[model samples]
Target: MTVIHNLGFPRIGKQRELKRAVEAYWAGELPQGALLQTGKELRSRHWALQKAAGLDLIPVGDFAWYDQILEWTCLLGAVPARFEHAATADVDLDTLFRMARGRAPQGKPAAACEMTKWFDTNYHYIVPEIQPNQSFRLARTALLEQIAEAVEAGYNVKPVIPGPLTWLWLAKGEAYTQGATDAAKLDLLPALLPVYQDVLARIQALGIEWVQIDEPILAVDLPAVWRDAFKGVYSSLQQGSLKVLLATYFDGLRDNVSVLNGLPVEGVHIDAVRAPEQIAAVRAQLSAEQVLSVGIINGRNIWRTDLDKVAQLLKPLKAELGDKLWIAPSCSLLHVPVDVEGEEGLDAELFSWLSFATQKLDELQWLRALVDNKVDATVEAALEAQRKALKTRAESPRTHNPTVAEKVGKLTTLQRDRAPFSERIAAQQARLNLPAFPTTTIGSFPQTQDIRKLRRDWRSGALSDTAYEKEIRAEIERVIRFQEDIDLDVLVHGEAERNDMVEYFGELLGGFAFTQNGWVQSYGSRCVKPPIIFGDVLRVMPMTVAWSQYAQSLTTRPVKGMLTGPVTMLQWSFVRDDQSRADTCRQLALALRDEVHDLEAAGVKIIQIDEPAIREGLPLRKADWDAYLQWAVDCFRISTSNIENDTQIHTHMCYSEFNDIIEAIAAMDADVITIETSRSNMELLEAFENFHYPNDIGPGVYDIHSPNIPDQAWMVELMRKAAKRLPAERLWVNPDCGLKTRGWPETTEALKTMVAAAKELRQA
Candidate 1:
């Protein structure tokens, strides 16, 4: 009677119902009640699906309106001071939305909470802001209410919450912001545990037996004090009726395994898929009374699990622990898409090897049945099918391309070498003739609704190629006119014909497959359909040359040939598992290198190869950082170093702390690098200040993620802060990331203000 449960499920629906509902609510097209109803329906549907998959205790409290971390912020009454709310007052839906979006009913909007990548995944979470004397209370009842909803539906529910240690670990304290140590932040745990007790007490009142408290920081290289806090934190937390199953994932717990010995908890979940070698050590640490939940299935990836292999790993454990042995995905299914069943037009052979959230559940059920010696005819058939599918995937001719491999093997340091940045910047300045504090954007302009409809129509054959290109050219011309009118120094094509930055290149490149419904949430209301790199990556032809050429034709200003960098293209997609990530990344780099050659040949003066995922792809452990950074940096250099000095290779990163990785970043040798700093009020520039970074920097003057308009004075002040640290001439004005998600009105106003701010910087 081995139990099976999921740590978390995808919040966005199979067809992305949550995204539609949330976006509609944001636009005032849908009422608040309707949005809430949509959420309820999605939860009910997801719960039913989880039940159908034979989960013993379905997870609750994983669904979120914006982000799971933000939900916890509200639940713990940790809203920032700018919202002007009571510390202990229950956070309502409006206040939660305001914190996420910085929107106010009237007047100027509150500054939205800072957002950054969650662990190493592409998913973004709202960074919780904490005060020096932050006190916590159970301010919101959403978690308890969701558990009640599941119980009402006749399902045993496992309530999920971020562990107190991990929550406090992820939080950005005021003291830390002003240069206090991470160890100092752990001192707030005394005040925080009472709320954790209260929340668990409430769940116990609802008759729930166990709660999943995620403490993923256990996998990271924590300070000794932070590591020391985990035992005390869990010890205090277990003084309640509800049993705590402390979960850690994304990486292995090496020396940290010793910390789990005789822990005061009912169960401990370890990510066996990522660190299977630690299973024995971890099991040895857990007491006989403590349940051991092994995450055997892949949660972050879309590959189908091999039931035979999984059963072998779990069978020994099943005998050892009997009913106490539990199984789940290595992490939350929130990282992957919802279902693969709805995927249309994908290759049958490739489709067989694919698994999404629903399929992962099916794998979990099949594995449990096999390990428990209860495999029925249906389960047996599923196992055989999985066996054949995996075998075929290993032997498929489509998976290999000799020419691609030959090209990658013959690669040399020659391709990675570039002219010095000092020389390159001088050449670029002379070639482009740009002013001081040059104003530009991070590649894309606003992608309007009409452009989306045109793409859909064109792809569906409703619109002819001639008509499609004509419409795209019209949009590009409009973008060029707008940039010139704003007096911006550099311009982009607006990427009118592109659907996604990665997917667009994937569609053009060889050895990639796509799904009609393979959507995963990048952040709130923003979903990305990651391309599946099923084989060798090759540049079949030009990806963005024609678009860049057209935009350049429309403007005397330098129009950047925008391409998603190889490292980003690798990290952002469901890459092939058969090959090493480093090898797959190099293959991608070669492909993008060809594309860069084409862009430069097409006379594109500036080329922005966006490596935003470079930071996101960084390894969690400090010991493992060099190996990852070496390959990641090499891949980026391989893509752009082939171009001339004056081409001005530019890269953009979002929401990362680069103080540690500044040398690796500088090694990429991009002439200009832009990063998101609007949310943190340009506090990110301190890294550049500390290092005296050589290249020009574009510290974003405004947040493009929000709809709120930033005035010229505000933008000027942000630039002024940037100017105080670095040379004013080395600074560039831009907004954070792309303007694709923004509407036309705000995009225009923000760009206008950004350009004006750059001018004011010159005057100063």
Candidate 2:
């Protein structure tokens, strides 16, 4: 019989109870005991819900207050020294809050480590900083307690964890202190192993058979030495405690399959959703003692899995692994939004085609049942649901836009480029009268609570359309005056019309649907409900031209019209299954192309199309990265091409590694590219230095993630570091991303320092 297993579930509760409880606990409205109790209750409720949904192996240890990575940090006592104050048994909720929020007790400044996008998702993780010679302990036994709770509730649980390799690989630290390898400084594994051993002993004592150690980094192109390190660590831990299920997701292991098979773990999990061909190769390579967890369900997307298609994909693995086969999701449910049932306001037709965490649980249960040859009434019901859902979605009028489809097909790749960067830059500089090392923001001022309230009022129709327009325009005018006062070389509308960079565009576009309660946790208390792409995406009207034109009207300086690039919009949304991502992205490009034309016609001098999600969408394997990049670069070009050379297209990419894709970045060929580098101290500039990139560039001089204002000295040092790698004449000065999350005082001070730093460099 095929065992049904869930790799993980959404920790955000049915009604986002976890989010509320965590926030309340942080704000001191709820006691620590109440917070822990809420978490415990949520876990029990989820387990019971899965049981009711007929899941055979319900996963535990997937629930967390903030993130699973942080939980693992606690489990392994891998807390950096900054958060070590929470190590005491009597540690108050204040200590935990401080670690997560980057706040501290009175008289102590916040020692916040940098936060950035996690992989390609909007979600953020607290990056662990490890010093050389760091020691580890079993800090908190959260996992053990969770397991015990599952047992007490009469359900067996599979514990889930981010593998040590992925955890260490994701962490960041200060500059090297000695000749140690970058991986060795955080070699807390030697210390971390005993803690795992202790946790395993308890799990074994409790008779739990399986624990998933997710080593997604195995799919990456790693150095040979790390492969040996992986073997050593797994060999050391395979002491018959809890049977290890070493899982790898996001991409195929390919040549690294040997390293995966070499480990002493009991089973291996492979992602068939992304790379279906991996099954046969993995089946041929499996040893007799090992089990195979076949990842058949799509976890990262909302599309209903083609059951017959996926069932056929799993047949080879079942034939080889036999009863040892476990069917599960490709990865954690974290990437997808929470339960679809909670989306009361979602379009009914669009909702039919989608599955959230709850529905996914039901899908897995039926997949196992069908595989076991017990295909009876229950299985039939699920299959019916799946069939009906697809039928409704496919036939729905919402999915078809003949006009959009026709226009999109006619669009050529040439639409992405205005002109060659050198020519465009020269024309733009002359036309706009920009200063040397011209400074501009990445577009967006603080999304203050008052703005949020007004937006909510407008959205709910409590405020009239005229009132909303007046309020947002006034805000834009205020922003224009501020930029003019600061003598900024370029300006923006501050994006008060936008609630989110992508969501704002999504709202104006046809063939997309928004949800009232589809909030998925981005990081900490923050959440984003990505629009559902149900059909062909097309822009009915210009999304941002009105605001851009208004800001341009208020300023003599060049106002940069902003839009999320096609690749970014597609990556951030839950896209359609019938259309290839490339097709959807092209459709979006066509729509954005119209907007670019509209903006340029409205006297918008400079345009910034932000493709921050470009690098995030890169295939996890090196072999496949190029193909994805080609289409992604083409999408950006297609979107921005309607503008003239003097329009000066700029693009912003933040929280992603661009070193590997420098050529692709160059291929997009925007007049200027601003990237996030303040935290890395312009080490990212080294990518351009290595490639001798020809375009004008902006490596942000100040970190925008933190509230603490960076002074002129900090900005000056960053500029100095960047200048060493980039020519001063080729550089533009900017902040990392936007000032949306920052207060006005902090934003003003930081920009002032940034401008002063640019002035200092000019003088030198």
Candidate 3:
């Protein structure tokens, strides 16, 4: 019989129980025991759900209180020196949270481990810090305990771990040698492999039959040395009694397929959803004894799976490999929401075309039944319904927009400003009449508990529309007054009316559907529900004009009309898969262009269209970047270009390695650009300096992601470092990103210090 399995499942409960529990613990409302219990319960529920769904091999060791990577770091005894003393089991939660979020418990300050994107996805992982004399031991018990828990529950479980090669590849710092390259970090893999070996031995001792070792780095362009290292590491690992299934996803294993095939593992899982063309090639290289786990359902997206197509793809494999064939998702269901069934008030038509994690698992189970010739009448009806929904969505007039398509097709050079950078800067300065070293925020203010409650009440019909508008207006007025009191040069409306930058706009636009429980973790305790764009994106009316006008009415100081940029809107959302991403992005850009024209018409002088996901959307391989960047840059320009020169277009990007894409960034040609630099200590400014970037720039003066506030002197010092590379006149001061996640007390104090620091720099 063919095995049906899932790579992993979302740990956040149907109603986001984990997020609430984690936040409560951070706020001192919940105890450590409570938090741990919540994690245990979530893991238990997820495991049971997979088993009840009829999956043959449910995965364990994928749950984490913070991040799976951070868990792996602690498991390997690679805790950085700062938290080394607290690495004991008694204080493990404290140490792990510190590494993930940085802590100031009882006034004792500890900096967080560095965080970056997990591949191209919005999910972030804590970067492992290693020293020159790093060592590894199997010190943590979470993975083993989870595996044991699942086994005790009477279910067949496959323990999952980041493979040795991918673990070392994702790690940072020159641990084994001084000034080592990322490839050289693999030298520590020798010390790391023993720990993994011990882990496998322990799992084997528990009578675990299979272990899923994830080596997602196989999807990337790897160094020959790293490819060679995979063999040595797996050779040591495969010697254990536990059968190893090497998993790769997120992209095709093109040239790396040969290297993966040569490994002596019992099974190999390839992402057929991402690269179906490579399936035949992968099958040719597989041995008869090796289980071929084919990923048929898309794990990252939200669309309903086409069962007919998947059945066709898997039928030939079943005939050739019989019991050796396995069915799975393209990757972990961690990227998607829990269940689409829980969603209320979604358009019935769109809902029928969507599938969250639970629905996807059902799809996987149905596909297996079809392949095994075990389909019943109920299963046949479900498949038929799926086919009808797919056909309806494809032919639906709701998805087509003749006007939007015509507009995109008739694009011209008018999509760029007529004036050069120098001229445009002069024009903007003349209109706005701001100070040197001006101060402004990226976009939003804190979305506090009270604000969230008000929005929730409004959504649930507990609060009237009149009452909600009154509250939102009051919040906007308060923000404007606070910005004036701080003596900031420019101000933002604080975006109190919005939930997420992308989702807020998506809700107002055509061709989008949102979920009530479609939450995915962006980082520790930060969850986002990415809206689904099912068709051609169109701006039916103005999205941000009312709030922008209200904000401007309260202040003589220029208030930026905050909008999420086209690239970010497309990148952050669950976009349509039928069309090219570039085409979808262009359609979004046109929609945003209409919004920009509306904001400009409302007399909003400064508009900050945030493109934080621009760098995040770049292809993993460098060779594929130029084409992606061309369209991405074009989309950004198309969004902001319709406005006048004096309109002062500003864009914000955060948590990216901007040096590699500085040229493409400059090509976007915003009047001003703000970036996240405080975490890197203004190191990103070097790119602007090297390129002699002429436009105004804001190298963030404070790391808004952290709760610890920077003193005025600290902010001044960072400004001085930025000054070394940027002309003071061209400098703007801002926080790393939106202040949406922060408390009011911290946000107020941080902005006060920031404003004071900018004034100090102006005097200097």
Candidate 4:
């Protein structure tokens, strides 16, 4: 019989109990003990669910207070010099909170670790800081405690964690990160391996049989040194009595499969759903005695599995390998919502075609029974349900719109090409003469509690449409006055009427679905409910024109028409898998193109099409980058071009490295581009040092993600660094990203200081 197990599960409660508890703890209302108790309760509940699902080995150490990578940071005792942790009986929860949030209970703030997307997923993890000669000790005992907690509950558990090579590979020191010499970090592997050995020793003492050591980096194009280091790292693990299951996901091992040819590991898990072609190559490397776990379920999106197709594929493998074959998800279920059974009022047909974390578990169980040729009544029902859902989705007429398809087909280079940058900039300057280092914001402003309540009341029908519009207009007026008072050169309506950048548009557009509660964690306690794009995307009327018109009517200052770009709307949402992603994105681009035309007609001077996920949507392998980048750039251009030369199109990208895709970015041809660089202190300017980017650039003056405010001098200094790379006239002063999650006071002060810094730059 084939074994069924999960790599991990979503830690946040279905209703976001962990986010509420942790946020309350940060606000000083809930005590640390109470917050910890909530975690324990959630863990117990989750572990019990996994056991009831009939998993062969329940996953432990998958629960995290903040992030799994940061959890490992504490476990390795790799605390940076700025942070000071205390000793606790269990774990230093306070210190862990401080490192993630940058505040230590009433004390001075330490700079939080740099955060970035986790390997093409929307989830964010705190990047580990590894300095030169960084030594390690067992700093955290939470993993061990969780293991014991699961064992005491009478469940056989497999402890999952990042391997030493991946941890060091992801760190940000001299040799720790990519594009650097791996020799330095590889040399420290000798010191790090003993820590792993010690950790495995404690886990082995718990009577656990296998440790799922994840090495997702092997899926990427890795340096040769890092590839060589994995062998020695796992080879040393042979000293322990426990068996190790080396897991890699998101992509195949590619050439990295050769390194594991004769490794000492007992099992290897491959993401067959993503890279099934490499299964034969990987199976060739494994010995007959070793177990091979095939991740056959789709873990990234919320789509139901095709049971018959999967059974056909796995049955042959099951016959070849027999009981040695294992079935699991392509990756952890952390990227998806917890359960779809609880979701109500969504489209009934779409619901049938959906599968959340809990539902995926059911699919995995049925897969096992199907492969074993033991179709009991329960498994048969599941198989039938899966078959019905797959059939309905395949033949649904709602998935296609002839008009939208015609529009997308008609789009060409003429629709994408704009006026030359030199001519367009001169026209823009002639229409609206501004300062050398002008000040502006990315798009949104602070979305305060009152603003959230107003939206809630409107949605619940407690507030009439007239009243809602009145209140939103009042808020826009206040925002306009605030920007004017702060002397920001360009202004936005603060997006007070919007709920989310993507969801607001989805609500007004065709071929989209919304859920009552479909939350996925974006970063630390912050969660995003992504829209479901199930059909052709077409906005019937304008999405942002009304709001932009109202805001512009309130002030003479240039008010931006804020819109989430085609790529971001497609990348961030649970996009339909029926068509090619490139086609769906092109459809979205054609739809948004109509909005750009309307916004320009409404007298909105500058329109921002936010494509922060462009880099996030890049293919994992370099060989596939050009094809993806071509469509991505074309989609952005189709959405942004064909405007008046003086309309001044702008785009914003945040928290992603641009050195690799700089040319594709330039090809988008926006009049101005703003990017997040404050977290790295203008370090991202290196992208511009080589590439002669023609258009204007704004390398964000301050990071808007953090609550810590930088003064005018700090903003001036950052702008000065940017000024060195490009001419003063080409530099715009703006915050790193939107201020949706921030409080009003901080947003006000930050903008005031930013405007003052722009003045200083102008004077210089």
Candidate 5:
């Protein structure tokens, strides 16, 4: 019989129990014990779900309350000096967050671990700090406990751990890591290997069959030295009693396939979801003794698998490997949401077309059964539902708008900008009548649980539509008051109306399909179920104007209407593979163009359309960068073209590494651009310096992601550095992104210091 395995399960519970528990623990409403209890309950629930779905190998050690990478850091004891002391005791969740976000609990000045987006995904992870002279010791006790927990719960679990190569690959630079390269950090691994060996020995003693070692770095371009290191590391690891299944996901292992051929590891898992062409090559290349786990299910998407197509794709591989071929998700099920069955508010037709985590497992299980000739009529029925969903999506009126397509095709480069920056600035100043050295937040305030619950309740019909609108409006009013109190120059409605920057737009636009539970992990425990763009996208209604106008009604400060830009919305969504991304992006731009004009007509003086993901979505290879950037830049221009020159188009980017595409960033031609720079100490602005960005700019003065209150003096020093690099009149003072991740007290204190710092700069 073919084995069914999961690389990892989603840690956040079906109802987002982990998020609620974590927030409650932080709020002091729940204790640490309660948080741990919630984790246990979630883990048990996940195990039960996977078992009921008939998985042969349910994974342990992959569940993390925070992040798997951080767990790897803790396991190896490669923590920076700051977190080392904290981990000396049992790793507390609060201490972990403190280390990750940089909160100083004991009066020590907080230095947060650097955070960056995880591989083109919106999720953020804590970058492990490894000094050049760093040493690692095996400290994988936490992982051991998880294994014990699973065994104690009566499940024979496959323990999951990040492979050595991926662990080092995911780490930040030593100057960033406080100074360590893998070569300099090599001594630490010698100490680290024993703990992993011991853990394997312990599992073997407990009669555990297999352990999954994930080395996803194999998909990326690697140095020859690293390949040699992989050979040496696995050779040493082969001493362990438990069999190793080295799993590689996300992309194809092209050149690196031979590196695994001679390795002592028992089995290897490949991601067939992304690179299906590699299966034959991998099968041909692997030694005859090796067992191949084919990842046939689409873990990252909501579209139902055509079982016949998957069965056909796998038949040849199955013919070669027979029962040796294990069927698994392309990567981890953590990327998918738990259940589509619970989504009552979604379009019934669209819902039928989708599969969440539960559905996906069933799909894989049934596919294996089909191959084994054990599938029932239920399998046939499910396949039909998928076919119907695809058909409905393709033929539905929701998928097209002739007017929107025509508008996109007609757009010129001139639409990218109404006028040059110098003229636009003068025009904008005249229209808005705002003070100098403007201060405004990106968009969102904290997404408190009550707000989430209210939205959920309203969606489920537990709360009346009127009640939901009243609650959201009340939140907007509160935010407007707060901004006024801070004396901000430009204001935002706090984005309480939006569940996500991109999802909000997708919900308003035509030709978008939402899945009942199509979730993909952004990073750690946070997941985003992005709405799918199946066809041409267009805006039929004003999405943000009503909220912006309402917020404006409460303030004299010029409120900036916010929207996720065309390129960002396209990049973030699961776009149709058939359409040229440029064509689709242009369609979205045309849709947003209507909204820009609508906001302008509503008397909103400034419109800040955020395109944070634009630079991130760039192709990894430098060879293909320009083509992607050109269309991306043009899309932004087309979207904002309908607005008048004096309307003052502003854009905000968060967690951006804006080095390579400085010219493309310049080409977006927004009058003002706010970028996240606080954590990097204005270092991210080097691209702007090199390119000589002529637009008014805001490089965030303080890291808003952290709850630590930055002193006014700290912001003043950052502004002082920024002033040297940027002309003063062209500089705007703002927090890095939104204050959504922060509590109100911290947000208020940080902004107060930020405002004071700006005031001091003005005096200077």
Candidate 6:
């Protein structure tokens, strides 16, 4: 019989119970014991769900209180020296959260460890910090406890860990000397392998037969040295009694298959969803005894599996491999929501075309059954229904727009602004009349508990529309008055009427579906429910003009008409897969262009179109980047460039390395751009300096992602460093990103300090 399995499940509960529990613990409402108990309950529920879904091998150690990477950081005894005190049993959660998110507890502050994107995904992981001569020990209590808890519940479990090679490859440190030659951080792999060996030995003693070691870095191009290092590491690891299943995903292994074939592992898992051509090549290299886990369902998208098509693809493989074949998802289900059955009020037709994490598990099970020739009547009905939905989706008029297609085909270079950067800047300055070192926020204000409650009540019909509008307007008025009092140069309306930057606009646009429980984690305790774009995207009416005009009515200062950029809206949402991404992005750009024209007509002088996900959407390999950036940059320019010179355009990007793409960013040609830099201590400013970037720039003065506030003097110092790189007159001062996730008290004080710093620099 073919085995059915899943790589991982969503750790956030069906109703986001984990988010609430984690927030309560941080707020001191819930004790540590309560938090731990909630974790155990979630883990137990998930494991049982997987088993009841008929998974042959249930995965353990994928559940995390914060992030799986941070768990491994602690397990390897690589806790940074600053967090060493909290690594004990009593305050482990404190240490873990501090590493994931910097914290200030009892008037003492700890800067957070660095965080970055997880290999082209929106999920963020804590970057491991290592010294030149890093040593490791087996800190295996957490993994062992979770595995034991699952085993006691009477389920066959396979423990999972980030492979030793990938872990060291992802780690950060200065160069070190090994023997007579100098080597990078990955050279410490020799020291890291013994710890893995010890952990595997202990796991084997627990009666666990197989372990899944994930080496996702193999999907990228590897240096010859690192490829050779994989041999020594796996050779040492496979010496134990445990069987190792080497897993790779997100892309095909390509030429790395040769190195993989030489490894001494019992099984290999490849993502056939992303790179299906790899299937035949990998099967040719595998020995008859090696197990082949084929990923047929997409782990990154929300579409229902075309079961008939998948069966056709897998039938040939099953005939050749028999019981040695394992059916699974292309990657972990962590990228998707928990279930679609819990969502209500969706269009019946559209709902039939969708699937979430739970439904995907069932798809895997049914696919395995079909391959084994065990499909019963119920399974057959499901397969038939799925085929019908796919057929309907392909033919539906809802998925295409003739008018939008014609407009996209007619696009030309004439859509770009006629004026040069210098002329536009002068025109903007003449109209706006701002300060030398102006101060502004990126976009939003804090979405406090009361504001959230009011929105929820209004949505539920408990609050009248008239009353909700009055409340929202009062909040906006309060924000405008506060900015006036602070004497900031530029202002924002606080965005109290919106939910998420992308979802708010998505709800108002055509060709979108909203969900009630489709939450996916962006970072620790931060989850985003991305909207699904199912068809032709068009702007039916103005989305942000009313708010922008109302905000401008209260202040003489330039209040930016904030909007999420087209590329970002497309990148962040679950976009349609049938059409080309460029075509979909063009449709979104045309929709945004209408909104931009509306905002300009409303007398909003400054408009910000945030494209934070542009860097996130870049291809994993450098060779494939040009084509993506060309269309992406074109989409952004198409949305913002047709405005008047005095109507200044600003864009914001956060948490990405801009050095390599500085020229591409320059091509967007917005009047002003703000980016996240305070976390890197203004190191990103070097790119702007090197490029002699012509447009006005805002290197963020404070890190909004952290709770700890910066003093006025510190802000002044950071501003001085920025001034040294570029002319002070060309600089804008702002926080790294939006203030949506921050508390009101901190937001107030931080802006106050930021304004004061701007004044200090002006005097200096």
Could you tell me every candidate's TM-score relative to the true structure? 0.98, 0.92, 0.96, 0.98, 0.91, 0.96
How many Å off is the CA of 440 in candidate 2? 2.3
- Summing lDDT over every window of 10 consecutive residues in candidate 2, give the lowest-scoring window: 173-182
RMSD in angstroms between candidate 1 and the native structure over all alpha carbons: 1.4
Q: List the residue pairs that clash in candidate 3.
A: none
Q: How much lDDT does each candidate structure score?
A: 0.88, 0.79, 0.86, 0.87, 0.78, 0.86
Residue pairs whose backbone atoms clash in candidate 1:
none
lDDT of 3 by residue, 1-764 (tens): 67989999988888889999988888889887888899989988998889998899989987988899899998887877766544544336677787777772332446677778888899988877786557888778888988888899998999999987787777766344211334668656677888888889999988899999999988888877777777778888875567999999988888887885677899999889888988887887788898999998999999989888888879989999999999999999999989988687687888899988998989988898788888899899989989899998888988878987888787764546547878888888899998889999988999988999999999999999999999999999999999999898899998888999989999999888888878998888899989899888888889999989998999889999999999999988999988899999999988898889999999998888899899999987777899999999998888877567788889999888777899999999988999988866787798899999979999998877788888999999999999988888899999988999999999999999999899888899
> Candidate 4 on 576-695: residue-level lDDT in tens?
988899999988888898999999988887889999999999978898899999999998988876789999999999999898889999999999999988877787888876798889
User: Residue 716 deviation, candidate 1, in Å?
Assistant: 1.3
TM-score winner between candidates 2 and 6: 6
Which one wins by TM-score: 5 or 6?
Answer: 6
The alpha-carbon RMSD values of the candidates against the true structure, listed in the order shown, are 1.4, 3.1, 2.1, 1.6, 3.3, 2.5
Which residues of candidate 1, in runs, are more than 4 Å off? 104-108, 177-181
The sequence of per-residue lDDT tens digits that candidate 6 reaches over residues 199-279 is 888888888988999999888777777777777788889746799989999888887788776678999999998899999
Q: lDDT of candidate 2? A: 0.79
**Candidate 3 clash figure, as a count:** 0
- Candidate 3: C-alpha lDDT: 0.86
What TM-score does model 4 achieve against the real structure?
0.98
